[model samples]
Target chain A: MTSELAAGVSGARMIELGRGECLALLAGVPLGRVGFTRQALPVIRPVNHLVDGDTVVIRTHPGSALARHTTVDEVVVYEADDLDARTRTGWSVMVTGRASLVTAPWEAARYRALLIPWTDRDVDEIVSIQADLVTGYRLLR
Target chain B: MTSELAAGVSGARMIELGRGECLALLAGVPLGRVGFTRQALPVIRPVNHLVDGDTVVIRTHPGSALARHTTVDEVVVYEADDLDARTRTGWSVMVTGRASLVTAPWEAARYRALLIPWTDRDVDEIVSIQADLVTGYRLLR
Candidate 1:
């Protein structure tokens, strides 16, 4: 628990999560929001993801707009947040990194086994982001 | 319903919703993701918002990181998506606009009445993004 003195010293009491906490939130969470660009306009979608080391993995249909827009070495932002409305307490974590399609058959197979899509649509395209920065924040009631 | 022949045409199979349908999804939705920046570093977060005309309304506590980063007249991106895992059918909408604080006393009061925060934290600052562009896509199972 954070003390009143510490809160006073900081002026505001927002909780800050470090690298380990941020990693835990990213790894344990199933749903996240991905932000990318199509024709220089921003697009965001919610997706289920899997975290492996410093990389985040997601799958999409081969002919989808996301597949068309995202390219190797393109910058993308991925975020996940958990909030408890009752307590008004929550945490949000974001990962910004370079995105690339995982084309290697063995790597794709490994991700395919671990990252299961609830949709029946065949997700032939797999994208992964090599995170350059990971940060998170928590709010305490 | 879209016909199979229509689906065969490139870009003809895309599902498009008008202003009302898009606004309904934006207002009724509980969770959304916002893509913004601080010094060109992309930051994305899950937020709860309301629809105000052609703009998206969001409230954040004063002195918060998000509040600090977002200023009036700054361009930002807001996105909302609703997905059904079972049917593999969903819609996503993106809004690129300029951000401005809602500061008029009467206007703020009206917004305060219409917009309620999902979190109990104090939200003294309210910002609205007047969308310059709005686009959405629907997935057909």
Candidate 2:
């Protein structure tokens, strides 16, 4: 069964997403993947996140794989994409920045209020990735 | 609007996926994210891929970000997940391995016949990420 979502055309062009538009799209999505390294091997984890100003905030367990792999000042990537499963047309926004754990009380509280993990676990650590560089693209066809 | 897909329960236990199961799941999915590093920053790109034995073969443009970031023996992460949008219950599989440009004539031809890029672009590079270590998890609720 097809829904009202936009369908992919036979011959569509690629559209470059502006920085502002990329941020807007990223801020709107709830699920995103975090890219990082563990023991020098690249790793990706799907985490529920929220865009807080210029920072991408995600709730993770203090001992989660993400937390263990990410450290202060470590460069990480946060990407979110919205694609029509049927049409396979979508837009992807990627943010490259440094990741740091939220240690301050007020800031941690703020993140805690805004972001919630989709999985059940003790989520007290708030990892924030600075959205220093944003790049995006739209696939239409 | 509820579908018959698994709905996440409120207090479901986390299930660990074995290596064989993880590889099987990865082989079944047509799309996955490739994680790599560019200038020391972690990056993730979504691509259509197929599992050819222990190798994950994908097609991408020669000048694509993924192609530029990946080199011979470069460590990369390939991940795939199928989570319900409404229920948010799904399984995720991640493979950590080195990305290599397929140079063998026979392997390239084999990959070309089996894999196709989802985007409209000149896909001249056939990349194979060696599935060295596979890890997966299932969220049930």
Candidate 3:
């Protein structure tokens, strides 16, 4: 197939993923950025995450801005990417979801076991996003 | 001071930085992620960047996906982050700007002298983004 035809087919496939597939891709990646609002201004930060069923789980401290913004039902945007420079082939998935602080002991413990940050930072709050809209796209070389 | 008070003050400071302070932060960082759409799907990859006045400059191969997506007048998002795991302190800056392929011979040579990727990757296309909206925040311990 021509490059144009291939791109058309890929575009159709991307539209089909809509939200669920995007969530899956986001779950597979360990690193992503969470875009939220801090006092009406946009704040974006890198987060280490895990996919627990349909929710995206992130760990932070109680005093962290990430913890404060992610209350119980606030809307936020999350993005994750997997790319290869060699072939210039990769995909990025974005999830616009409702964030909630996971206060349940058991749920928090489970997340604590799975999602580990690459730093020795304090993690007192566990935030999870129940995605409302998930979208993704794959770039073919 | 109590942790609560510190957190409150830090949150306010972070919000201020998120509004306009990102321009300087963007200039200081050497590496960042360039986000673009390929086949209508969002893709992001790590790249070495240079600050040329109010624009972010990065180079790629002639036939790279980034080169294709970053046509003249195309809007793209460029993000850079500096994180310190010891204190759990970090900052991220993002630039949503218009991208164009750099063709000026002397300008391209100047960029070649400053921005060099740490990998043996092929780079033939030089792209620059004139920042339209810049936002960022720093996390306090």
TM-score of chain A of each: 0.84, 0.85, 0.81
For candidate 3 chain A, which ten residues in a row score worst on lDDT?
A7-16
Per-residue lDDT of model 3, residues A3-121, tens digit only: 22333322112223557667778767667877665554344567778877777888777777778776647677677776553444567777777788988988787676666544434
Q: Candidate 1 - CAPRI tier? A: incorrect
Task: Give fnat, all candidates.
Answer: 0.21, 0.44, 0.02
> lDDT tens digits, residues B56-82, model 2?
888878877677656647878999998
Give the interface-residue alpha carbon RMSD of model 2.
7.7
What is the DockQ for all candidates, taken in turn? 0.20, 0.29, 0.08
Best by lDDT: 2
User: Model 2 compared with the native: what TM-score?
Assistant: 0.86
Give i-RMS (Å) per prediction.
8.8, 7.7, 10.7
Ranking by lDDT: 2, 1, 3
DockQ of 3: 0.08
TM-score for each model: 0.74, 0.86, 0.55
Clashes of 2: 3
Global lDDT of each candidate = 0.71, 0.78, 0.67
Q: Which ten residues in a row have the lowest lDDT in candidate 2 chain B?
A: B1-10
lDDT of 1 by residue, B27-134 (tens): 777667777765555668766688878889887778765676566476678888766544546787877877777878788666665555544457757878777878
lDDT of 3: 0.67
